[model samples]
Target: MKAVLGPFVPSYTGPWLAGVDEVGRGPLAGDVVAAAVILAPDRPIEGLNDSKQLTEKRRELLFEEIQGSAAAWCIARASVAEIDRLNILQASLLAMTRAVQGLARAPEHVLVDGNRLPQWEYSAEAVVKGDSRHPAISAASILAKVARDREMVAFDEQYPGYGFAGHKGYPTKTHLAALEKLGVTPIHRTSYAPVRERIEQIELF
Candidate 1:
């Protein structure tokens, strides 16, 4: 995929281009995590792919490798409450902007995964599957996924019944059953359809 995308072909023609991606967008709980990673143009990491395609162990290994290889990297999050307040799209963009702003070195160009680029000062291009095609984007995806997963795991320890560690806040059957049994927790996203429906049903009864 990298070869097909021509990562070496220099899409932005900038020396310092940062790629950004976010994770936990579809989850019913937890913050949306965004990461921005700038790679040294000359030292590209091999075997980079969309983080979703990789196993947890592989993603963790790549996350560590990216930390070492990137010229600059940062992760940021928009809380679940913020997501409810601003809406997910806006919250996600805010998280991306925060991640980029946190970077030590300012990026000359930004390559964002998915179609919409945040309203930011930097010039950017949005590629639909940038994470698989761009090294920096792939790095960012890994960082965001790993960070969010870790956060969900910690939430599992705190919440005790939701299986957050197992499903990472995704709306799985186990998660839904837990929600039905336990009612909503502070961590649950009330704005999400499943959660809202559950709440309404419980309220009626």
Candidate 2:
């Protein structure tokens, strides 16, 4: 791993550097949500780590704190229709791009949490597992995860029996069984293999 200057490190780059991350790539339903966060020099948030590594309660706490502390932050998403039209990977990237663009102020540079940088105009760098390595990216990851999870929970209410609240729209056994029983919903990503197969099966029968 290469060293970088971030708030987590002593050689802090100014808050102009925004960190970007996205969630919901593997979900069979809902949108791919992304977030960009710029942590100010004055606010140094602790417990900044990968969202996946934290408990749901911890992530929820961090999500709110990050919003309150960050100099600027934005959350954006590519809708289910957009996910079907554009591939998931592309849609995820597009969500991240939109997040950065939607920030309160444009960043001088961006540190993306994945290995692949989005098709973006701003100066950017991709850090593998950056959510764990960079505080700002971790903040973005927490925000994105919390936001998407809330959406899935809400979708569970709207589209009952799919267990969106529990599985968060992942291709879990419960979700697959629900799809088999309840059929696909409007939020389901028809482009995904599992969802597509179910759709094909439904069409045949």
The best candidate in terms of TM-score: 2
Cα RMSD for candidates in order: 2.6, 3.0
Off by over 4 Å in 1: 1-10
- Per-residue alpha-carbon lDDT of model 2 for 96-153, expressed as tens digits? 9999999999998899987798876888888877888888899999999999999999
> What TM-score does prediction 2 earn?
0.93
lDDT scores for all predictions?
Answer: 0.90, 0.91
Worst 10 residues of 1 by lDDT: 1-10
Rate residue 1 of model 2 by lDDT: 100
Worst 10 residues of 2 by lDDT: 3-12
Residue-level lDDT of model 1, residues 37-70, one tens digit each, is 9997777787788999999999999889888988
lDDT measured at residue 13 in model 1 versus the true structure, 0 to 100:
65
